[model samples]
Target: MKNRILSIDVLRGITICLMIVVNTPGSWSYVYAPLKHSEWHGCTPTDLVFPSFLFVVGLSMSISLKKLNRDNHRKIRNKLLKRGAVIFLIGLLLNWFPFYQTNIADLRIFGVLQRIALAFMLAGIVITLIQNTRSLILSLIALLLTHWSLLYFLGGTTPYDLESNISGTIDIWLLGSNHVYSGFGIPFDPEGLLGTLSSAAQVILGYLIGKNTLKHGKPGTKELNHLAVVSLSLIAVSLVWNFVYPINKPLWTGSYTLYTSGIITGFWAILIWVIDIGKKEKWTLPFKVFGQNPLASYVLSIIVVKLFIYVFKINGTTLYGWSFKHLFQRIFENHLASFMYALAFTFIIWLFAFWLYKKGKVIKI
Candidate 1:
């Protein structure tokens, strides 16, 4: 078997880096358009991050599941179930962590890790059930179409307004009132239940793409060309789909899936061309380290930042108060300064990831 692709690791690491950059902005209002999620009915560069992350999970599964085939089916299923449950629970715990400030009784039940866990479990079971590429492709198509049908035909009782879409209504009914994202001033979450089906499909699409890339023995110019062709085809299809469905992340619309998946495929194709085929080494070292220990870096980054802000009270204020973010805002008081603060914060997190890499300590799930 071919060893793990360094390019894939770098790609995953880059996605995680973008995730941190977007999520930990110094001031949300001043962020660049590419780093911001779309306000309503379209996909943005930032909208691609979550789907790209899930796609990487699928790419990883293509490798991991192949190894697990040596074991009995029951054992594999048990392991998948247990691992998925544990990851999902960890996500729930993170949501409620430092549980004093917020109401712990009804914390957000759905989050990044929870979505990952569910997508992994569902996609894993499907892969196990149907052991061929054609089946996987068919399943993905079925999921996307079914999800589209559900959302379109099962229009909300309140009408198909922008604010009261079918996805939000379903989430509100299923998740109850207390657990939805209030940031939108409505009972909806971009990572809601109905949208998860399409998210799982996104992962499956990644798995299919990964299987194709790996089927060729080595990364070659011909393979890169083929990848480019596939990427272009997906992008064309996604554009066509977007007209009818609208690329809305909140709804997790089918068009949104196609659009993000196209972008993700295009991104990996370029990375494979540059890093794998071109044999570029120098620029990728930091990303490779981050990729090697992504989950650990992500969780630790959040916890460490929160802890620092909580513990190091500076001048009757938190460490975050003394942060470049606040300092820049106080001095410049403009969007540009806010943008710089975000970049600095991102750099700091990267340094932390690099430090862990130097120690050769990677945390895995």
Candidate 2:
């Protein structure tokens, strides 16, 4: 609590809340446009949530890495591997949770936590190895540009088109058909292996921002002005890049990374100005609670949703069963019920987190 940055926690909390909102929409067919991810080669608000989470991961890494004064590189490496593996396994388990599905061979292997774990490990290793801001920046640029080049050149004639893309091809070959997403009628996952390279860069960028901000503590008007300048520059670059590459989440396009990173940076600047500089904490308490115990809140929400759908079996129907989800569908008799049900579920989870916070219980990895 003492070393925590209120603004960072608030950002993380807001992201988690939005993740639940976008993820648990009453019905996929009726979701608002912004809540749905882009079909293939464009972005929706939902597309930003995962990258924003990755950015925040980088921010948290900055803090953690800064505090590690020990020179035990081996120990740090082991810790990163262990933690990353654990987080990735949790995500995988959640994907195959209850572990009783007959289609076990076709279960998804990569997901949100898996992406986070991979990104965190890669970014941590990079930060550990580079040890210089300028070099880190160069590395990020190199990674992004290299990815773009590889996708463009190696992908050959039908670049950016979903069916023939190298990224998807590699994923299928490596992860196998059963382990990849068939939602698009092919074996592809948005969080697939190649896409994760850019994701790691996203986290690295966050680490850079956090490290700089902490170094320039008690950000004055001058620091705020500098942030504004950087944000604007990034937006301008992102806009240009979007024209060339397009903002795509499934592909994890370079433009999408820049665009989302710019937005998050701008968002961070505004929050810092308003809350940290303006000294406003009262309005941020709810978010702070979730932020402080995000993993607990997220894992608990998933468990609760599963339990409600499985153990409770309201009216002999699964929570997500056509009948149960439809009960509210009939009550509200529209998309609104689905949305409200999801919101209520989210709120219940928040209340649980708040209760835990009240008891001074914070779960960590």
Candidate 3:
């Protein structure tokens, strides 16, 4: 039990680390290919980061929600609502942070943390209602298929087209173009309402895996073999489905969910093998710290970056740009310099995380 939990913490920490690195490049234009999200279709390492965090969220839920019983339903419901709302509100505030710089009415309505909050709440409710593994599996299947059908049937000829897809259309209609993400050169949000269906399914998959791990007792060689088989099966099925539906991150396609969850599950299995079975845990401290306080670390990193970009200035340039150009860009090629800046920034956050760990602080939110 101890080793299994440690592996989860490490997985979460790794995800948070990569998220900070990818999101804090010196210049978006100069980022390496792997760190950048795919143009539209297909997935990248960066694309997997967010879903991996959600997968961890689900895995954590499996442990936390295990205490749920009929008598505690009301208490759990209130707890879920309160936590979900708080997380969603924080994401919203982050979107509009440095309030003077943001137009109040035009802020993006959905984002990474918001998606996590929603998926967590939805998955919690589903898990509570369906304790049976078979029923939960069926629920997961229904979510994926329902999302796919909506996109293909409701979307016109070009179902997966960036501009015309059903998801984007719905987002624009409901949230208004001004309030939706314009990153895709359209009023589309990757974390929009329609995508939540698949996102919830992703969480349920993680929960199911975690529940299975608990049911089978402590992870060992036999458990590792089972995870490998399941992970490979998910990967194979997703690859085949990719030909038809295409694995898209922005759309949060079913194939993308399956592919990412499979990859993360396989990684988790490796962690258990190394940290538990082999007892090779000497290098796990940093990740364990990160895992212990992920929410605080992630939120702090974003707030600090926002301050650098929006509030601080150096010789007529934002502090972020000035530091990147003067310190990093001057030392190396554009892409490498950009990457170096991200690495340094990630290190700063890691230091903060380490301090919190040393002080025995684990920010629960």
Query: What's each prediction's TM-score?
Result: 0.92, 0.94, 0.97
lDDT of 3 by residue, 1-365 (tens): 35348888899999999999999999998999999999999988899899999999888877877777778867887788789889999999999998998898999989989999888888777877776889999999999999999999999999998977999999888989999999877688999989989999999999889878866556788889989998999999999999999999999999999999999999999999998788888899989888999998899899999999999998889999999999998899999999999999999999999999999887886
Residue-level error in angstroms, candidate 3, position 209? 0.3
Whole-model alpha-carbon lDDT for candidate 2:
0.82
Q: Rate the local accuracy (lDDT) of all candidates.
A: 0.78, 0.82, 0.90
CA lDDT, candidate 1, residue 281: 73
lDDT of 2 by residue, 1-365 (tens): 65677889999999888888777766777776777888888778888898999999988888777755447655776798789999999988888766674267888988889988998888878888777899999999987997788789878797788887888888888878889977887777888888878898999999998888877554557767777777788778988988878788888878888889988888988888888889988999889888988877887777776766656666666756554366667788556776877787789889988998899887877
| Stretches of candidate 2 exceeding 4 Å from the true structure | 68-70, 309-312, 321-327, 330-333
After best superposition, candidate 2 residue 120: deviation in angstroms?
A: 0.5
Clashing pairs in 1: none
RMSD in Å for all candidates: 2.4, 2.0, 1.4
Output the number of the lDDT-best candidate: 3
Better of 2 and 3 by TM-score: 3
lDDT tens digits by residue: candidate 1, 112-216: 888888877877777777767898899999989988888878776532345767777777788786887777877677777777788888888888888777875
Model 3 weakest 10-residue run by lDDT? 1-10
